[model samples]
Target: MITKVTYLIATILSVKAFPQNIQLLSQLPSDPIEQPDSWAWGRHPKEGFGYKARNSLTLEQCIDNPETAGTVHCDGYDYSYPVELCISMPRLAPLKVCADAKFPKDFCVSNAANMVKAKGCQKFLTDMCIMDISLATSQPCADAEFPKDFCVANAVKLIKANGCQSYLTDLCTADVSLAVSSDCAGVKFPASACTSNANFAILDNCKGVEFPASFCTTSVQIALLDNCKDAKLPKEFCVNGDLRMIKAKGCSKFLGDICSQSLELANSADCLPAQKSVSVFRCTRSRDICLSQLCELKVRDKGSCPQ
Candidate 1:
């Protein structure tokens, strides 16, 4: 059973800047395959799509070849993951960075941006979609430390430069993969030019199986779970804390989800209902917070306060 814990909505609303035409997406046509289900198994329908079936090498093949990479299986299997999965974590670039008549043409921004506009012009919405993609592509991006837009932005650059192509069958795939395999994306340097500051290529999430259940490090997860009190947190989050609940940050905007934005809709509950809330960036997993806002104001329940 799902628990609905009450939360004290924040009194303040933090206004964010959304673009004037960000809502122009209703004018764009969506790709049907990009719908929810097909995207999960990482299906890529484009031509040069899909991985090779023989990506995994057996011990015998490796022993005979003496040049085999490893015994593990790779997505190089006969199907390509969705483009979204390839660059799973998404981050928004300025409308300027990805703004081209040719964007996502050959562009994913066309699809992602549409999803962005439909969310009523909010970063949180954009972030959530990207996060979901990141999870599909790699689990770590779901953590607070790994924002989704970041992945989207980076992946866009890689795809655009590659001219839409890849899979193990092609000796040369997309630019990002090409760069990694050939070590020429400038993501790294030649032996003479290599430095610690080089932009490191990271494996996507599920690929990072032993990655300590957080992005880049363990501390980030600990701090977030500590703060939010773990409303709907997954277990991968840490569980070390006082277990005391605190007023959730940005509760007003997020509060509506706990019940109804309309007082009448929420009050429809015959009795006091417990509202469950999960903070956006909590790291550690802990007990759910139980909250009640309408009453603590100390107003008399009898007469009713301002609607």
Candidate 2:
């Protein structure tokens, strides 16, 4: 009877121990399951967000998978597509968001004011404002902005009050004039403001302002004569070589003689190549013989030229 009881107890202990041993074996750590390197979460254009298994699955398949569902989040939501996914996947190439977005009128003006305070109005207009502000537009502008016309109106007011010398300086003179005549039409600016800068004196809007005689230096005179001699009026205004002309004329006449007869020249078929060469005179100064030949041909009748 004692042997039988001892054997039975031993059997019971062995059964329990067997299960305990199995549990211990189960608890031991094993190699981790490797995740696919190509898999990542991305935003879906229409369905919000999902995982993107770039190597193994298409965008549609990833979105369709039950494991990839999520909410969208992004700063420039109105101006961006596949919105939240752009922010979520920082490792991916950046998307061009708000590329064509324009700042709200009040907000743009306010931001312009802040920029002016930081860097002065000259830097704001010349350096910052001239760049494409549309790309800089974000959710704030979309949410709080007004119409573009309103923005232009207020911007003009800001310029008038703070002084727009830098805005009206150099090539900016023509750009500002065009803006005034078209989109900013009927927006009156002080004549004094236009005439203040010698650069603006040549523009039609700033007519009656005397051409500063001191502006035409020896280099400017040479460039003007070289590039514009024998060229016709109205058709091929020396607009193409305006930068070179401006550089030759110095800062006093920074706004080259774009509208004048002396500076106006032919950019017509005969002179196009020569005009191009003249435009880059600083680079092609040694090609004087080529330029003279082209210029001579420009004035001669078609029949007089050699084949």
CA displacement after TM-score superposition, residue 301 of candidate 1 (Å): 99
How would you encode candidate 2's per-residue C-alpha lDDT over 175-221 as one tens digit per residue? 45444444334333344545454443334444443333232232343
**Which 10-residue span in candidate 2 carries the lowest summed lDDT?**
252-261
Q: What is the C-alpha lDDT of each candidate?
A: 0.28, 0.34
TM-score of 1: 0.14
TM match of model 2 to true structure: 0.19
Candidate 2's clash total is 1
Question: TM-score for each prediction?
Answer: 0.14, 0.19
Name the runs in model 2 displaced over 4 angstroms: 1-67, 71-134, 137-174, 177-180, 197-307
In angstroms, the error of model 1 at 197 is 14
